[model samples]
Structures are given as C-alpha cells and as structure tokens.
Target chain A: MKTRVIVTLKSGVLDPQGKAVHHALTGLGFDGVNDVRIGKIVELDLADGTSEAQIDEMCRKLLANTVIENYRIEQA
Target chain B: MKSAVIVFPGSNCDRDLAVAFRDVTGKDAAMVWHGESTLPDGIDVIGIPGGFSYGDYLRSGAMAARSPVMRAVAEAAARGVAVIGVCNGFQVLTEAGMLPGALMRNATLNFVCRDVDLTVANSQTMFTSQYADGQSIRIPVAHHDGNFSADEATLDRLEGEGRVAFRYAGNVNGAARNIAGIVNDAGNVLGLMPHPERMTSDAHGGTDGRRIFEGLFSALA
Candidate 1:
C-alpha cells in the first residue's frame, strides 16, 4: 500500500516562503492572486495491513507539527 | 555540576557548548552521542547545541527530536534535570514537545546572523537567574528558521506564568511577542534560537551569554 500525506501550515500562521513566491508572481505582472500558502506532500510506501491508526500516529509523531501545521493522510 | 552535551550527526556547536559548560561548572562535560539510548548517570544539566542536525532535513531539528537520545533527554527533563536547547536545539525541543511553539522561516526570507539586543524577561528561572529582570544583553543568532509562533492562548499562558525568559529588544526574526527564549512550566527546560555558547567569552566580542551558563551552574550547585 502507498500513502500520501499533505502537510500545510495552520491558518493564521505566517508563511514567509509562500509570501516571497507571491511577491515574485506579482512582480512578474500576474494579477488576481489573492493569497498563497505553501505546503509539502510526503509519499510513503507501506507494507500490507498498515492501519489508518498507524498512519495517523505517524502524522502526529513526525509527519506534521501540530503546533503550526496540519496534515492529511490518503491511502491508495 | 555534572553536565552533558548531546551531539547529533551534524552538530557543530557541541564542542562550544561543552566548553561553556566546563568553564562555568569547572567540570568536564560529557559528550553524548545522539544514538545513545541513555545519558551518563547523574547528569545535572544537558546542553543541546546549535548546528544543522541531520542537515535540517524534513525540518530543522525534526529528525533529531525523534532520535534515541532525545527520548533520554525527555526522561531526564522529567526528572528535573536542566535542559538548554539553543538554536537548532530549540527547534528540537519544540519538535520533541518539550517546549511549546514552532520556529518558522524568517519573515525576511533571509538567514539572519548577527548580534541582537535582548531583554531578560524573567530572571527567576534556573536558566536566567544570573541576569537582572529587564536587563538588556546582546546575543548572536544565526538561523534561517527562527521565527517563533504559538496560538494566542498559549502565548498568553506563557506570559502569565513568566515563562518567557528573554525577549528581543528589536524584532530580529519575526518571533511572536519578540520572544527570544522561553522556559518550561517546570522551569527546568529552556529553548532559545540565539547562540549563548557563541557569546560566552569577551573574546567573542561579548560575554553576555556567559551569565546563562553561570546561572545554571549556581542553580544546579
């Protein structure tokens, strides 16, 4: 089985890199961009019988820092 | 005081921290590898120095927080051992849940490396006892991810309890409330982005950082 985890900064948190990219876009003459927030996607290849609870544990333990970020896990 | 400095794979400031510990405590600080499952017996202080641990992979100090030695550090902290996490060490403490808040990229999107003025917020803790309350001092900080953030309620609690140990005199890294360093509720653990070890001697252009080590040694003694 394979799992994908999307980690994103929580709302109200500052994303400096995302802001920098947004600025560059504006400088390049792009318009109508309200905001931008950057995040990361982590793909994991797990063995059979991996439980959702285990994946959630992984997210809580290492994949995401609950203090400033949130993570979603998807299995396929 | 018996002290130990945790050395991760990419830790470059472990020696500097050890020297600071030795100079203040008059004892040879042990160098414990991150792979160790346990620290040396009867340690009074544990120093987590600055460096690009694990090359800051995944996240700054994220991988190191999960290393074998951090488990031991957490246990020691629970036993009332003094733990000081500086720079990357601060990131590890937050990641290990030993401290609250997360350090994000600087708002300037640039790596900041210079001496900055800091005010001693609370001098009652074991870590800041050497400095007078509201005293201004200069410390050097070198990091790209030193911006500290925490929820409003948590920040309020930290402030209410006087857990904030140091606050920047000027906004250096966009940290919330200008927090330069903080202590845990138990007052045994401290996490800060500035490198006190680098400022330990006058030869380094300042000796303001030496007070922290001196304070810890006297408290532990």
Candidate 2:
C-alpha cells in the first residue's frame, strides 16, 4: 500500500517563501491572488494493511510538526 | 566540570563546542556520536552544537531530533544536569519537544549570519548566571531558521516565569517578541540559536560567549 502525506503550514503562520513567490506572480502581471502558502508532499510505500493509527502516529511523531504545520494522509 | 558534546554526521561546530567546554572546565569534553545510545559517565553538562544535521532534510533538525543519543540527553536533563543546545542544536531540541517553541525560517527568507546584540532577558538561569539582567552582549548567529515563535499563552507563561534567557536587541529575525533563547520548565535545558561557542575566544573578536560556559561550570562546581 502507498500513502501520500501533504504537509502545510498552519494558518496565521508566516510563509516567507510563499510570499516571495506571490510577489513574483504579481510582478508578472498576475492579479486577484489573495495569498500563497507553501507545503510539501511525502509519499510512503508501506506494507499492505498499515493501520490508520500507525500512520497517524507517524505524522505526529515525524512527518509533520504539529506546532507549525498540519498534515493530511491520503491512501492511494 | 565533566562535559560532553553530541556530534551528528554534519555537525561542524562540535569541535568548537568541545573547545569551549575545555576552555571553561579545563577538561576535554567527550564527543558522543549520534548513533550512541549511552553517554559517558558523570557528565555535568552536555553540548549540542550547530550545523546542518542530517543535511537539514525533511525539516531543520527534524531527522537528528529522533537520534539515539538525544534519548540519553533527555534522560540526563531529567536528572537536573545542564543541557545546552546551540544553533541547529536549538532547533533539534525544539523539534525533540524538549524546548517550548518552534524556530521557523527567517522572515526575510535569508540565511542570517552576523554578530548581533542579545539582551539577557533572564540572568538567573544556569546558562546565564554570569550576565546581569537586561545586559546586552554581542554574539554571532548563523542560521536560516532562527525565528523563534510559540503560542501566545506559552509566551506569556515563559515571560511570567522568567524562562526567557535571551532576546534580540532588534528585529534580527522575525522571532516573536524577539525571543532568542529559552529554557525548559525545570530550567535544566537551554536552547538558543546564537553561537555562544563561536564568541568565546578572544581571537574570534570578543569573549562575550565565554561567560555562558564559565557560568555553567561555576554553577555546576
């Protein structure tokens, strides 16, 4: 089984890299952009029947820092 | 004082930290590898130095935080032994959940490297006893993610309880309230982004960082 994890900075957290990209977009004449936030996607190839609780534990323990980011696990 | 410096694969400042420890305690600091599950006997202080540990992969200090040696460090800290984490070490401690807040990337998105002024927010900590309260000292900070931030409640509690050890004199990073260094609730663990070890020797320019180690040694003595 394969799992996909998407990690994103929590709301109200400053995203400087995202902000710089937003600026570049504005400089290129792009408009109507309210905000931009950057995140990462981690794909894991796990053994079949990996329990949901175990995956959640992996996210909490290492995949995402709950202090600054949130993570979503997707099964594929 | 019997000191030990933890060394990860990419830790460049481990030797510098060891030298600082030797300078203050007049004894060589044991360089404990990250893979080691146990530390040397009778360690009075532990130093976690700066560098791109685990190549700063996944996230800053993320990979190194879960290493074997950190478990021993945590146990020693629980025993009231002094633990100091500097630069990348600070990030590791926070990632390991030993520190209160998280260090984010600099607001400017640049690697900040320079000698900046740090005001001693609380001089009563085991790490800052040699400095006077509110005294401003110059030290070098070289890191990309040194912006320290925590929730409002945690920040208030830290300030109220006097756990904040150092604060930037100006807006060096986009740190919340200019917080530069902090200690755990027990005041036995300290995590700071600045390189106090780098500033300890006179040949490096100023000896402002020496007082931290000196204070720790004297306090332990």
Index of the highest-DockQ prediction: 1
Q: Report clash pairs, candidate 2.
A: none
lDDT of each: 0.94, 0.94
Q: What digit string (tens of lDDT, one per residue) describes model 1 on residues B9-113? A: 999899999999998988899999999999999999999999999999989999999999999999999999999999999999999999999999998989999
lDDT of 2: 0.94
Supply the TM-score for candidate 1: 0.98
lDDT of 2 by residue, B1-221 (tens): 69999999899999999999998888999999999999999999999999999999998999999999999999999999899999999999999999988999999999999999999999999989999999999999999999997889999999999999999999988999999999999998999999999998879999999999999899889
Compute DockQ for each candidate against the true complex: 0.93, 0.87
> TM-score of predicted model 2?
0.99
Task: Give the TM-score of candidate 1 (chain A).
Answer: 0.95
